[model samples]
Structure formats: structure tokens, C-alpha cells
Target: MSLTMAILMLVGMWLSVAAAMLWGVLRIVRRHSHHHRPPLVPAKPQPVRRPRRPAGVH
Candidate 1:
């Protein structure tokens, strides 16, 4: 095939691959953000207190 034909084919292949990737990514993003219901997150635990150390222990 001629150089021009080869270049055109290469460009078309690249564009097709890019479009497929874009479509896949968009579908995944939409599925992730659908928000049919609110997400459930575990409640935070309360911090425990530490005992004080003795003074003048140098």
C-alpha cells in the first residue's frame, strides 16, 4: 500500500481504539456515580484516654 494509505489506516485504528476506551471509561464512571442509595460508612470510634506518667524520674 502507498504511504498515504498506510498513514490513514494507522490514524483510523488509533481513533477507533481511543473511542472504545472513552466509551468504556464513561460507562464505568456512570455506573459508579449512579447513587441509587446513599453509601454506608462505618461510624468513627471514640479515642481512649492514656494514664499520666510520674514526675521527677530523670
Candidate 2:
């Protein structure tokens, strides 16, 4: 193979390897992140009420 062809092939192989490693790392990160997340169903918020005024007091 010509020098240029050999150089291109070497670079391409390295790029593919890097891409594969990156994909695996990201996959693991996503999995762990989901494991720590709260449940999908959210709890209902409690209603707040003002205390009743004393009898005859404004």
C-alpha cells in the first residue's frame, strides 16, 4: 500500500477504537444515573389552609 493509504488506515482504526470506548463509557453512565433517580410517579402535594380567625376577632 502507498504511504498515504497506510497513514489513513492507521488513523481510521484509532478513531473507530476511540468511538467504541466512548460509547461504552456513556452507556454505563446513563445506566447508573437512572438507578439513582426517583420514581416516575410523583407524590401529590398537600393543601395548605389558613387557621380560622378567633370568634368576633377581625
Question: In candidate 2, which residue pairs get closer than 3 Å at backbone N, Cα or C atoms, i.e. clash?
Answer: none
Q: List, residue by residue over 1-58, the lDDT tens digit for candidate 2.
A: 9999999999999999999999999999988897786767758876888999999998
lDDT of 1 by residue, 1-58 (tens): 9999999999999999999999999999999888777877769967889887789764
In the order shown, what is each candidate's alpha-carbon RMSD?
A: 8.9, 4.5
Local error of candidate 1 at residue 9 (angstroms): 0.2
**What are the Cα lDDT values of the candidates?**
0.91, 0.92
Query: CA shift at 16, candidate 1, in angstroms?
Result: 0.2
Poorest lDDT segment (10 consecutive residues) of candidate 2: 37-46
